[model samples]
Target: MTTALVTGASRGIGRAIAVALSERGDRVAVHYGHDREAAEETRSLLTGDGHLVVGGDLADPAGARAVVDTALEAFGGIDVLVNNAALAPSPATLHKIDETSYEHWDQVWSQMLDLDLRAPANVSFLVARALISAGRPGAIVNVGSRGAFRGEPDFPAYGAAKAGLHAMGQSLAVALAPHGIAVTSVAPGFVGTDRQEQTLAGARGEAIRAQSPFGRVATPEEVAAAVVYLTSPQSQWASGAVLDLNGASHLRT
Candidate 1:
């Protein structure tokens, strides 16, 4: 059976991706940054047995290696990887250029770039090398954000990191093609995940939903559906693509 590792699977979109992978009969390695309890809960939601849970602080380069090694050790090899772990744009990460201090700006920028961009780069490299050595075709999908194109006024670092992620996926797609490893990314707009529930319930909820003609934000399942496709063997031809899941809210052109 194909085995998958979904980083940040402790909750929200990551958890949804893991569940979808499991539903398709793939064994999953659910990874969390710092929440072992939540990661275990994700394992309980999977459809099949043999699903594993791993935890590590990917911001540290060594942690990325540890995560991949743990998953590889348990599953023999990882056929799919969903880089869904990220430091999203919460109040903690907010750094609007105008109102933020230099020290806060540096802190947020460094934290976001390290975890959201650098971590994925390291993990992708490690996983790609493992796949090449084993001579197995595999898929890597990065969960990007529309903010990369639409503009994250409040979280510029988040936008920049995601933009870098998309570019990295495209570059890796070309680099890994000869080895039969496909790479792609999905740029989603505002999604209604558990982490976003408070935001969607607050005063700005109406404005956020109004951004799309559908008058609603996307669901975690919607993003998970995209991941499910991107990580499948049938989607090999779709490598190098940065599919936009913004509900037509932000069209790039």
Candidate 2:
């Protein structure tokens, strides 16, 4: 069976992705930034044995390497690496130019880029290198965002970082192909996760749903399903692609 490492698997899309991988009989290493209890919940929700719970602050370079090393040790080898951890745009992180202070803007931008873009790049590098050394064919799927193209007025740094992530995935895809390692990314639109429930129940809910023709936001499972497919052996030829899971909300030319 394939071994998969899913970062930020404590909740939201990461949790759903871990569940999907486990359901398909893959051994999963659920990595959480914090919240050991939540990570344990994710492990318990899995269907089979061999699932592991790893925790670390991915924003730190050493922590990111330690996370990969822990998973590699537990699973022996990781066939799939899903870079799903990110500092999402919450009220606390939102830095609108007009309303936010310069210091706040700089801080938020740095934090978001560090966790969202650099962390994933570092994890991907570690995983790719391991696969290369082992001469194993593997896949790396990055969890990007539609905000990269659609724009995030209130959270510009988020959009910029995601854009960089997508670009980095493409670069790695090309670099890793000769080693039989596929790399790709998914640009998902707004997803209906538990963390977003409050916003969905609020006054702006309808407006957010109306962004897509289906009049609803994407679900975590939907994104997870796509990730499952992208990381499968059959999808090796689909590497270097940034598949859009935005439900036609925003189409790129």
Which candidate number has the best lDDT?
Answer: 2
- Tens digits of per-residue lDDT for model 1, 23-60: 99999999999889999999999998999999999989
TM-score of 2: 0.99
**What's the CA RMSD of model 2 in angstroms?**
0.6
Runs in model 2 lying further than 4 Å from the true structure: none
**What's the lDDT for all of these models?**
0.95, 0.96
Which 10 consecutive residues of model 2 have the lowest summed lDDT?
70-79
Report clash pairs, candidate 2: none
Cα lDDT over the full model 1: 0.95
The alpha-carbon RMSD values of the candidates against the true structure, listed in the order shown, are: 0.7, 0.6
